[model samples]
Each structure stands twice: as structure tokens, then as C-alpha cells.
Target: MSRRTDNRHRVATICRRATGLTHDTCLRWAADGLITRQRPVPDAGTPQQRAFEARLFAELAAGAVLGLTGIRPARAEPALALHADRAREVLDALLPRLDGTGALRGVPGLRLVPDGGSWWLTDLVDRVARVRLLHPRPGWGPRPGPTARQDGGRDPLWRTHRHALHPAEAALLYGRAKEDGASWDRDLLFSRTLRRLRLIVDAGAQHGWVRLDTTGAYDLVIECCCASGALKLMHGLRQSALAQERDDEGPGYSGDIDVGGACVAVRHASCGSFPQPVAGPDLRWVTC
Candidate 1:
């Protein structure tokens, strides 16, 4: 066996050699509470911590050599589940609040369900969830449709006023988008909706109609508009107070507002939209 030059060579050197990541990166990870390091007590230390450090080093080194950092991105599995559970709870608390005269009062007649699939109803649920996350109360409205004419003609009425679109109108818009080849991928769709939701919250807060609270939920106050002909749309939103915090604590918001009117219908027309609101038998009418 070769002679060991020093104890440092055995531990720190081995760690650096095994991980392929820079010594600083390893140390940073350790400092950030991501990885733990062990030091022998003059002669002995915890074997578990030592093993973990060695394994992490080795994995990093291997990743470097293969140009494949085996480290998976951090995820919030437990937090996500918790958020989903909380979403269900919040939904339960919200439906009753929708009963009286207001934007939500029209939901019963629209056959709203808990499922995130119906266009108008899902929009409503999403708006509520968003408000709950941003302020104490939640609200959302239809996104404006394309101003330019498409090859088929002006976009459908539903596309222009999804919030106001009837079932028949939604069906027509869905067919049109499918025909035009404008639908996006799941990841893209989620990202777009998230951005749009933020903008809506900001606009409402600025107008003094809503307030985005510390928990990311909103406090909403609906005002009656005399414009009876204006189309109304609802949004279905999901917020996770337990998951992550907003990046900044500024009074302003950033990001694009182009949440594609074309793709919104795909979410609006599905079955998941309505059933997501009511719990049991109360769901019958909404589902129908």
C-alpha cells in the first residue's frame, strides 16, 4: 500500500477528487445546509456524515467527467402535496362565499364544477385561488382577444370575451384554435398562465379593487358595472403558500401579459374545471 502523506489528503482531497465540483462549490453546498461535512474527533467521527460527504463528492466528480451533473433540481414534493390539500380546503371555504350577488353568483347558472376543465367555471375557481394567494379575496376577468383578423376571419366571440362565452361559444372557439394550430405545450401553458395571473393581481391591486396580502392571497371587492353587455370570464388558479416565496418584495410586478386567448379554451372546456369547486351532491348541478 502507498504511504498516506497526511490526514487532510485522505478527507478533503478525496472529497474534492470524488466530486469533480470545485472545492468552493462543495464548501458552499455544505454551508448552505444542502450537504453536511464531518470531522473526526482527533481520531473518530460520525461515519454517516462522512459517508454522505464522500458520496456527494463522488457524484459531483462523476457528473463533471461525464458532463452530466447527476444532481437533480430541487423539488417541493411534500410542500406541493400540502399546497394541493390547502387548495382543496380553500375551495371548500370559497364556494359558499360565491352564493350571493356578485361575479361569482352567476356561476350556479353556468354549471360551474370543481374540475379545472370547464372554461368559465374553471376561470372563476382559478381567480378565487389566485385571490386567496395574493389577497384576502380573489377575482379574475376575461383576457382580450386578438385585435387583428385571422385567416378564418375575426377570432370567435368566445376568444374575444371568454369570461362571457356560453358553452356553445366555448365549443366553437375550441374548434377554431384546433383548426389554427395554436395550442402550446403543458410547460409553456403553465408558465404563461402564472405570468398572466400575477399581472391581473397587480392591476386589480393598483385599481384598489384587490389587495395582495403577505401570504400571496388577495382581498377582493367587486364593484358593479353598468355595462351589461361586457363579457365576463373566470379563472382557475392554484397557490402554494407552503411551497416558495416570491423572489422580491417590491410594490411592482414584472413579466408579460400575453396569456394567449387561443390556448385558454383548452383548459376552460375540460371536465376538471367544475368538479373542483363543490364537494359532493352539491356538485350535481354544476357538473350538469
Candidate 2:
């Protein structure tokens, strides 16, 4: 079958693996206009239809990860609601900003900040806000808790949850990376969108936390480095993170600084040989 047809068939499988969400949930979210107002993909759909579904699923998955600050869950409705418009805005702004090589042109490393009832995408180093969107439910927070205002009539409380996207995650979710003479793998895009996930799996002879799903990691390596370099970069990423762990407090180090959980996963994987980096390729996508 043509790759496109194959991809259409695999969308459900790939989305399930990537988002840990059933096909029904994603479609329902899409139908409810959570992320986008567009109609969900049909069983037999066009490439555009598949792309739309893939993008929405990816965005939803990212929201789930960032909402919980690196903890990926099977379903996160509240997180999805918090991120819906912002995710759409980010995808809208960044996708076209990518050049022919799937790298953001003249963009800085981006950070997402939740303040008050809005989500802002900002320049990481400068703290300059680039894109902002109001949350679907204003003043939304966890349930059954006292907000600052609720406590003795103090100022309205808002906890800012900020997350930085590794360049790879940004590109995978929003960039248009094409393969030579072949349609890019839309299924790969779904899987790559799930990079924020921390998978606890057994490596060769050991068990530890891995950043990328094992199948997704292999597909990424094969796509970028070919069969010969398969797993070379993945190993390098694990090794590099392990080396960094020794110089710091290791996985136990829990400060505000976050590399999208790359630090924690690598430290945890020190005893094993897995865990890809949060940032995919070290290519210079941004100045920061």
C-alpha cells in the first residue's frame, strides 16, 4: 500500500501509543473543539484530514505532559482545556516559521508559561512573550483546594506552571520535515509529539526511565542516521545526560530548571543504556 494509505490506517494505532489515549477520546476532543474547531478525521480520510488529526493529537499529548510538568497520563481533560487555545496558537505560529529544513528560522528557544488564566509562549532566555491565549476556563486550577484569594481574602492566587520545549519537540510537533522522494511519516510525527513522555522500560540487562518510546526512538534514529547509525545518537544522548548527572545532584535534583524531564530521565537511566534526549538533534534551530 502507498505510505499515505498506510499512514491513514495507522493513525489510530500511532495516536494510541503516543498519547496513551483511545481513538474515541481523541476524536471526541477534536469533535468538541478542544484544540481545534475542525472536524475529526474520518475512517477513510484524506492526507489533510490525517494531518489535522495527528496535529491535534500531538498538541493534546503535549498539553498533558506540560500540564502535569512532565508526568504523562492516559487522559488529561483539565490540562487539555488549559492548553487548547495556546497549543493551537503555538502550532499556528511555529509551523510556518519553520524553514525548508524543518528548523525554526530566527526563533529563540521557546517557553510556555501559565499565568492568571492565560498561556504565553515566550523567548526562553529573554522572557519576552511571543504568543498568548486565554484559557478556556478562566482561573482554572486543581479542584477542592483553597486558592490564595480563598485564604483570608488575600490576593487571587495563581501558580505559574512554566515548561520549556526542547528544540526537537518543537520541531516534531510543528515543523515540516520531509523525506526525499517519499511522503514524510505522519505516524512518526504522532510518536515524536509524544517525546515529553517518560517511559519506564527495561534496557539491555537493566531497567530505568527512558525519554522516548523504544519504537519511536528507533524510528527516529533510522530516519535521521540510517540503519548503520541506529541507536548511536540515542546512546550518545543517554551517555551525555549520564555524564551531566555526575556533575550535579542527579535525578534527585529538583529545582525550577527543567529540560523537559531529560535531566531526570537520564539520571535515572545511569544504570541502563536507554533514554533518548528531550532535544532530538543538536542542530542549531535557535540562538538560545
Candidate 3:
């Protein structure tokens, strides 16, 4: 095993060995909030804490490697069995957002293992037992494979997730360099989006659906702009709390904004050049 004094390299060693990633890619993932650590701060954490981070990263990265190759990474059966119930609960809560994507409807349940790179939504179960959905690469674009781009492009919801990615995020997720445009204004758009994603993820132990946490960190980002279109909307949003809107499709929750006493569903469109805020049946709202 390679050893390093630098904290980035120390963690990178685990990530690299696990997924054959370059040290720089691992560093970028850390900077981008892609792979969260137990004690995520730099040299400030203890060696034992650091070691734990490495192990966790290794597992996550290893699973990601499997996913990149179009394989659904699974946890050891015993380990998966313990958290089976929790997995199903979380999945139940998340399915409506995934309605149109067709990625999770077939999912019967999930496992506690590394759901891969972003911890997006790889854990899943089918009729027989728990299976995993292949985690996408870090990009808002498609995974690197024959069908990745075609599959991703065809789905409007998938495109909306892509819209959420900033150029910087795109770079890190795709193993590329940070993009730099010739002029400041040209780069502004990407910078602003990246800032938003960074801010949202940093405030979390749960960085949106990228990782699941108890605090419901994803609740905000997934909500559509229509629900909070204006200052008036925010004031209205204060009137009520996010509640589960369950139906025959599945059990799921959303924060609906009261518009003239009419609750408007916050269905953030996952596709199209302009994502509109109107009531629709349901679309799986996975993160970009």
C-alpha cells in the first residue's frame, strides 16, 4: 500500500486503490462534497478517524467502480439484512420523486452498503430480494458507456438533474479539470450553481439525496421553484410543513405551497430547457 503524509493523499490512497482513481480525482471529490468522510475536515481529524474515513471511502469507491462497469454493487448478505427495513422505509419515502425515471419502481428494497460514488440511489430491491441500481458517474451527463448518454438524454427528468450540475461539478464528477472561461462573466453561471450545490451539501450530514441522513437535508433542493416563486410564497410556505402525499403509486412526501389556499405540488421538473412548476402525476426527482 502506498503511504502519504498529506491528508488528501492519505484518503486518496484508499479511494485510488479501491477505484483506480488518480489522487487528484479523490481530492476533487473531497472538495466537491462528493465523497463525504466521517471526520471530513483535513489534518484536524485524528489518525483513527482518518483511518475510518479511508475504509469508508474504500467501500464506497469500490462499489462505484462496480457501477461504472455497469454492475450493481451489493453488500454482503448479512450486513444488508440488518438494515433491510430502514432501506425500504427510505425507498418508500423517495419513490414518487423517481416515478418517471423507471430506475427505482422495480426496486423492491435496498441494502446498507455503499450505494456507490455519490451515495445517490444505488441500494434497491426487486421482487426476489435487494438489488442495486448502478450509480451514475459524478457528471450531470451520462455514465461512460454505450448506452449511458442515450439513456440519460432521452429522459427529461435525467436532463433536469444534469441541469443542476455546474461546470465545476461536472469536471469533478467526470474526472476532468475545473473549467475556466476566458472572461469572468462567462464563468459566472457555473460558479453560482457550484456555490449553491456546495452550500447545500456542506450544511449537511446528508448532502441532498447524494447521501441519506436523518435531518431531511434533501427536502429543500428537491422542492420546485414554483412552490417558493416569490417572497409571498416563502411567507405562505411558513404556514405549513412538508407532509407525506401518499397514493396508489407509492408513499412519498412533498412541501406544497399554498396558493390562494390551494396547495400547489412542488414537482421540480427533471427535464426540459425550462422546468415549469405545475401539478403533474409525479416524476422521480433525483439530484443532478
Candidate 4:
């Protein structure tokens, strides 16, 4: 039927067509700001119904904009396109250097490292890409804690930890050189990197393998956050370097280890209201 000929029919049709909303539901949505009326209703019969239908269509449009609509487009292309391209470039450059056994036996700038008896860059590129696609936000919620730790004075291991990235991730996000200036690309990279680091921390905590303690000579310690477990290995390397320095310089070098490079901060919070779930390992052994 021609919409102009029957106003009620037109209104009902648009309401149902746009949002699959009933006439009454459309009216509620309109009142709730979920939708808006297209035009002023006539001062006659069915005015309320006409207003309701207009609002329904508006709500439906809003739904589409907020990605709440069922008919939204697939996210593969628009969300992760750039990330996928960069990952491909990094892999292409690094993969060729692997030995005949698919091991990074001899590669410059990139080396094959081991973690949990496995070999992988912890698939960091993929981790960064996935995090960017899912959460393009500035910060993450608090990490979860054990149910027993809900009350005060829980062990430090049950606390939530927050961390910022190191130079490599920051460089990718803010651009290799500062003079290149800010752009959407840099913003996306920075946001993605933050999200990825949070995820990495969470995953490590869940496995009960990650530890953050400053009691040792080092000011900050990060264990098991790298792709090849390089973070842990790096800690050993630093200790070795310090030992060598001490041996060469004698007892005069009785100073604090200057490991004050950037590290994720771990702090205790009440477990009852933690913002997110904590998965993986039990970290109770590592005192904060």
C-alpha cells in the first residue's frame, strides 16, 4: 500500500521494518531517547501511534551506529586491517631466518627463544592485533583476585597489577620518530599496545607463573611476559651482568641495582569488587 495514502499504515510499516519493534514498543523507545520522531504528529486520531513509529525507526538507526544491531558489518576488514598488514610484514622478515627445523637458530635483530619448553615469540604480534580489534580503549579494568581474598589484609599476591609498555611497543604505537607527528595510526597503535600489555599481564597471572617483586636487588621484575620467555631470561642476564660488574669493581660497588626501567605496577585491592577476572597461575608465592 502507498504510505502517503494511509498514515497509520506508513508509521506501522516503518517502525516494524526499521527495528522489528512493535508499535507500543516503538512508543516507549521514543520516550526513552532510544529513538526520535520524524515529524510532529497530527492533532487527530492515531497521532500517538504515528509518533511511536517514527521513534522506532530512529532507535533502530541508533542501534546500528552503536554496533548493537544484528545486521552490523563483519569486523575483520575495517578493525584489524592495518594490524594484519604490519604483522604480515614482521613475520615475513623474521620467518626466513629460521633454520631448516623451523627454529630461529641464527637471525639478526630477531632470535628464537624458549618459554615453558616451547618456541614462539609468544605470538606477540597476534596478541597486539587481537587486543586492538577488541578493545580500543585507554585503560583496562582492575584485575580479579581470589574469592578468599575478598576481605582486607589479603596476601600481596592476590592483588591486581597495572603496567605500561616498554620502548619497543611504545615506539610502534607513538611512531618510531616523534617528528612524524600524531595521527589516527599512532593513536590506534598506542591504544592497542596498552590493551595488549594488560592482557599479557592477566594471562601470566592466571597461570600462576608470573611474578612481580622488588625485594631483590632490582627495583622491578617482570617474569614470563615475553614471547620466548625473554623477559625472565633477560632478568637472569641482568643478574649475570651485575655479578660480573661487582667482581671487576670489588666491594666498593655495594649499591642498589639500577633496574628502574619501566615496569608494570602490582598493587593490592579488595577482591570483592575487582573489575575483571583473574585467570592462569597462582601467584601467592611471590611477595609484592
Winning candidate number (TM-score):
2
lDDT of 2 by residue, 180-202 (tens): 33333544233223321222111
Which one wins by lDDT: 1 or 2? 2
**Per-residue lDDT of 177-252 in model 3, one digit per residue for the tens?**
2444332221221111111222222221121122211123221222322222322222222221111221111223
Which is superior by lDDT, 1 or 3? 3
For each candidate in the order shown, give its overall lDDT on alpha carbons. 0.24, 0.32, 0.28, 0.28
> Candidate 1, TM-score vs. the true structure?
0.19
Expressed as tens digits, the lDDT of each residue in 152-245 for candidate 4 is: 4231211221133333344443544365533333232222222122222332443323333443333333344323443333332222232223
On residues 1-288, what C-alpha lDDT tens digit does candidate 1 reach at each position? 233223333333323332233456544444454432242101102232222222222222211111111111111100011121233332222221222221221111122232232111223212321111211123322234543223234433223344555454355436644774333332233322222232222222211122111112211111111111001112111111100122222222221112222112211122222223333333223221
Model 1 poorest ten-residue lDDT run: 73-82
User: Which should have the higher TM-score, number 1 or number 3?
Assistant: 1
Give candidate 4 regions above 4 Å deviation. 1-175, 178-207, 211-239, 242-256, 259-288
Separate clash counts for every candidate? 50, 0, 7, 9
Q: Which stretches of candidate 2 lie over 4 Å from their true place?
A: 1-45, 52-179, 184-210, 213-217, 221-268, 271-288
Give each model a TM-score: 0.19, 0.25, 0.18, 0.17
lDDT of 3 at 256: 37
**Top-lDDT candidate index:** 2
